[model samples]
Target chain A: MVENRPFLSFLTHLVLIVGVVIVVFPVYLAFVASTHGNGDFLSGLVPLLPGPNLIENYRLMLTEGISTAGAPPLWIMLGNSLVIAIIIAVGKIAISLLSAYAIVFFKFPFRLLAFWIIFITLMLPVEVRIIPTFKVVADLGLLNSYVGLTLPLIASATATFLFRQFFLTIPDELMEAARVDGAGPLKFFRDILLPLSRTNIAALFVILFIYGWVQYLWPLLVTTDSRYYTVVMGIKRLAATADGEPQWHLVMAAVMLAMLPPVLVVIFMQRLFVKGLVETEK
Target chain B: MATINLVDLKKNYGSVPAVKGINLSVKDGELIVLVGPSGCGKSTLLRMVAGLESVTSGRIEIAGRDVVKAEPAERDIAMVFQNYALYPHMTVRQNLEYGLKNRGTPREEIDRRVKEAADILEIGPMLDRKPRQLSGGQRQRVAMGRAIVREPAAFLFDEPLSNLDAKLRVQMRVEIRKLQRRLKTTSLYVTHDQLEAMTLADRLVVMNNGLVEQLGTPTEVYDRPATLFVAGFIGSPPMNLLSLESIAGAPGFEGLNLPDGTDVIGIRPDQLVLDQPTGQNLALAASVELLEPIGGESHLHVRLTGSNQAVILSVPGRPDIAEGAAVTLYARPADLHPFNRESGRRTDTAVANP
Candidate 1:
């Protein structure tokens, strides 16, 4: 911008173009595979061009699915994914918001100790505690239920920290003003704090929804009942048939379906997501 | 609307005292301005009165009721903050109505109060707009409007205009003064700016280092500052404080009877005359060091000829004086403020004879 550097600008554009292509190449290949017949992949390296069997592959996957793999229809898996993602996103936001509000506004014994304990949980991901978490869920008889799938993942340290940081940035005077305005604590949280946190909640929702949707290990570990299988984890069952040969067309179709909702969410809420992400970090 | 009494109010953050015991009575419907530099605890005192900060000890009474254990809302006070603190997501109308609604005011009552506040603040057109959409001054009006709609027992302003531009600050200062006069609301306003303090306060409480240095009418504090700190802090260009030894041998002080412990004397820059006038009791020969011509007046900085101490004199228009030129400055007996050097307390009696 400072100088009229045409060559440098050209080089910059070229690098970005290369980056975009590298990132989009795999999705493009999957889309191409989804549009082909199963026979096209048997000939050797999967066909690069579109085939006439696109509609049939997707329709078959969505309605009847691959019966041999014991996987339900694509629509059913997509519905389950949607429900689990919504619950996880909403639940995490609600819990994190309340905890963050309490930490920022109230004085209690061992307050910092409580905050530190929550912060320390960031070091232990679900993968590390998966076995114990599963045992607890099974003990509670919550396996195969929506609550079991979402509740275990709802206590997000990152989300709570983000909310806490955002709450700290709110001018202390605002709270004072609310207090002087005759608003009790719950009323202030409801009428002022929640409305102010709209963008943050939305942004966290996008991130958490994607997080819930892409869950493979936890859902696989818990949901033996196909009724609760998420589309993200269900695609694995569809791909790894008992014969060892994956139905390349149908698997690719399921993959595309599994990736669509989250991708759409990110694309549509991009502005709020970016704003929320940057502000929460601040 | 109500009187506020702070009875030995104190606050401590752990072991560090923010506001040492402060006792002051704000008369009914009086606007009391607490003026001090940052860290002087003026704001801390105000917050304690507003119930925003807890009192480490003592009591705060509004309308003769003890509010030491009460919530801020229960204290019946409204505060306008430095940052305005207008809810960013709410419309100006909604911001004004939020408190009334929370208190379960009827729909018609809320509407009437909101309209009255909007009319007074001249923000009727922007009531539907969010805070971010309005200009800074408009947002400030909305903040005031929010406080106005509450019709509480008192109003507390914590450096509310400190964030505005100089022109807007002056404008808002006049408007706030006019509004308080019309509403007859007991108010406690805080600011570090002495000019704002002097102009807006019915009575000014000058604070320093977590204590009240002096409290009086603006004219009283300016004309008779009780302590060296008040004298130095309250005036523009500040009162020129000089050691008694520096002026011991200067002209016109040969036979003056002075107090024994009087070591420092303060002179207002405007009262230091360049010409020898009738009834002038003190005169000092000094050489000019600098002349700052600010529009209609000039500030002449001069050093005493026999000593290195510098003093400033405010003269009308530009004086025909050059740097390094010898000048004689005069002051009457009443203009000289005498104080004890050790304790920084005023030592001069009410009467001074030359």
Candidate 2:
């Protein structure tokens, strides 16, 4: 831009185009495959263009699903995913906000120890502690339930840390001002601190919603009941039928459905998400 | 309005004392300004009064009631912060209404106070705008409006205008003084700016190193600074403090009778004259080092003829004085303040030979 080098600009465009193609190619292929008939994938490398059986594949997946594989209908799985995503997003925000507030504002014994304990959990992802976590959930009789799918995933160190960082950047004088305004601690937290955190909460919701939705291994581990299966894990069952070559058309259709809600969320709330992400991390 | 008293208020952070024992009685409806350079504990004292900081070893009483153990809210005081601390999410109306609402004021009363405050601040048109939408000066007004609506027993201002531009700062300073006079609220304002303190305060409490160096009206402190710290800290171009030993042999001291332990002399730059007068008690020959013409007055930086100790003299308009030129400066005996170097206290009992 500084020198106005046409060649460099052309090179930049070429590189961006290549990057975009690489990212978009797979989703395009999945859509193409979802539009095809059953025989297309069996004879050749999946279809590259729109097929005439698009409505049939999507309708079958949404209404009856591939029942032979023990997967529930797409609508039921999608609904489960929706419920799990919302609960995890809202739950993580609530707990993290309260914890972050306490950690940042109050002076209590063992506060640093508490913060470090929460911070240590960041190093331990769900995959690392999956087995023990599953046993605990099963022992609590939360297995095959929505709580089983979401609660374990709700204790997020990232979201807590984000809120803590955001809270720290707020001027100390604001707190003093609130105190002088006759607001007690809870009142200050509710009236001043919470409203100020709106953007951060929304931003974290988008990321956490996606995080809760795309969970495959955790849901696969806990929910043996078909009714509790989320679309993300249910797509695996649709793809791995017991006795035949997998139904590529329906599986691809289910995959498209599973990715849509979160993708739309990120797109629609793009501005707030970017702002929240940048500010909280700062 | 009510009198606020701080009796031997002290604060320490892990054995490091930030505010040493300080005692002051702020009269009802008086605008007291706590002023010093940064780290002077003026803010700490203000915060203690506001119940935002804990007092280590003394008491803060508001309206004759001991509030040492009370929360900030329970203390019944309002504060305007240095940054204006307006809630970014709330409209000006909401910000003003927030405090009264929390206190469970009746809806009609809240609206009445909010309207009155908005009218007083002349922010009526901006009541629906967020703080971020307002300018710095407007935000400052909203901050004050928030305090005004509370109608607390006292108002605590923590360097509220320090963040504005120079022009706006002066404007807000005048407006704040006018507003305080009209409201007659017991206010404790803090600032590191001496000019703001001098202009806005009914009485000024000048602080240094966590101690009150001087507490008096602006004129009293300026005319008779209690110590070397107050003498140097309160004035612009600061008072010229020269050790008496440096000019002990000067001609003007031939018939002078001074206090026994007097070692330092403070002379205001404005009091130093270019021409020797008939009744002036002190005269010294100085070599001009530099001249700074600041609009209507010129500051002549000069060194004593026999010593390297430099002193400044403020003369009206541009003077026909050049750098390195020898000029005789005179001061009346009454204008020269002598102090003991060890105690830094003015040796006011000094009697000069008549």
Candidate 3:
């Protein structure tokens, strides 16, 4: 009977493969378009295979000395993305781990209530809080600064919640053993609990890095000056049809730059992310 | 080596009391084991002594210093957990050295103690291997190494050998006892296995429902359990306890002044005799129900001819008897214990020779 279900099975695989292609094909197309000049891209000549002008195209994209009004240098924006992604990734993971450890292991009054309140933030969308959050940042003198861009995005509900769940799965007896080994709360956390949570931290690092890297609206609204723009924000500002029709090649180049860090993070830390989810079940 | 004293130690989680107020003391170089069924607070009491659990109202003294308010480190205690809790990322040598390193022990001393512990545990060759790479017994040895390197005031073990296989548990039990004796360190070990308690404890503190039922040498606890719970809880196949209507009535005889209105007769299967002359002792007439031969020993299960309850006699070798045979068995009066059925208390009585 399973063998006879040929059409259904074939259609299922076809639908799945087509869905994957649809999601990934846009990025592939952007890479192809970035390889060519604006005219070739406008003519809908999609490059199926590698072409010969790779160096020339890269030189044209990097031509910042000509005082081109629109395009930011691809490498510079890529570097900026790495900085922001690294800062936010490291900051978010550290804060989330500390917050999660406090909530999970510490003995304090109203801890459960605090955990619930922090968890409730996950239910509210960023759009609803964006206006007030921006006003608060502006009042705090953080606008157009790295602090403004990162502070709003660094302390995440998802990371804390994910890590808290992960911490709970650690056997309490192990913590007790650490305590008996002469480790105080800080020492226990540093020497024992924190080291054991590597897979979770690695997984959360990739997750938070991606979340910060892909952020468009928050960074766009926070940094009014283009000099402080993130890679994602830079991509949007460059791709806009403000002066005339959109510069598709420049936009694709910036978008491609903005997408690089996240792709690399996923590729490098895929095992950690998969391992984290597997351990969370345990 | 140190002495530990627990005075009225109690622990409560919300409304449920996990460990009722308990008092205990350990002399220097003594191995006291807290043993009970699950949820009986044996582990909780042990944790309290280690300062891992907050004392509701008590005074815990380690080597004559009050440690109730002190951190576990301040109390100078080392513990082996049920799961062994060897740092999964660290090798046996690293796991053993971590506590000393954190305490700022000199490198030479740390190395000396780690090597000494590895040699003591016979795990010297496996020192560089991580916990995940080792077997359960190996991890258990590493846990022991960690504790031994501390040379703390008292060593606390919370069901440390429970995770191993039965044969391994028995073997480790002997190793632990030998190690403790050689080191002469005061230790408090907790386990639910009565056999572990009986064999390893210099003195056993048997608890039930958060209360200490009996505390004494293993032989004392076994031969003269102060409470019915202790009598019933220990021993394999447990003690056979039968309810008797009166200590001075038809069930009672010249040899036993089974107190008037007594309700239970506690008899050890080994103490039960198969052959009794017509006028030798209290005859418990019964029909043979089953005979189970477990190697050199034969367990004869018998149902009293006129009674619903059956009695079991564990004897050496097989008896020339088949099932369904009617027989009268007798036991010396000294071999029985009469307990207050209402309170489950073992009532005292002088044994009389028949």
* iRMSD (1 decimal) for each model: 3.0, 3.0, 2.6
Question: Which consecutive 10 residues in model 3 chain A have the weakest lDDT in total?
Answer: A62-71
Candidate 2's C-alpha runs over 4 A off are: A2-9, A278-282, B349-354
Question: lDDT, candidate 1, residue A35?
Answer: 95
Q: Which candidate is the best by lDDT?
A: 1
The per-model DockQ list reads 0.61, 0.62, 0.51
Evaluation by lDDT, superior candidate among 1 and 2: 1
- Could you give candidate 3's per-residue lDDT for residues B147-219 as a string of tens digits? 9999998899999998999999999999999999999999999999999999999999999999998889998
Residue-by-residue lDDT tens digits, candidate 2, B15-134: 899999999999999999999999989999998998888889998989999999998888888899988888888889999998888889999999999899888889999999988888
Best by DockQ: 2
- Considering the two chains of model 2, state its CAPRI-style docking category: medium
DockQ of 2: 0.62
Task: Return the candidate ranking by lDDT, descending.
Answer: 1, 2, 3
TM-score of each: 0.94, 0.96, 0.91
Docking class of 1: medium
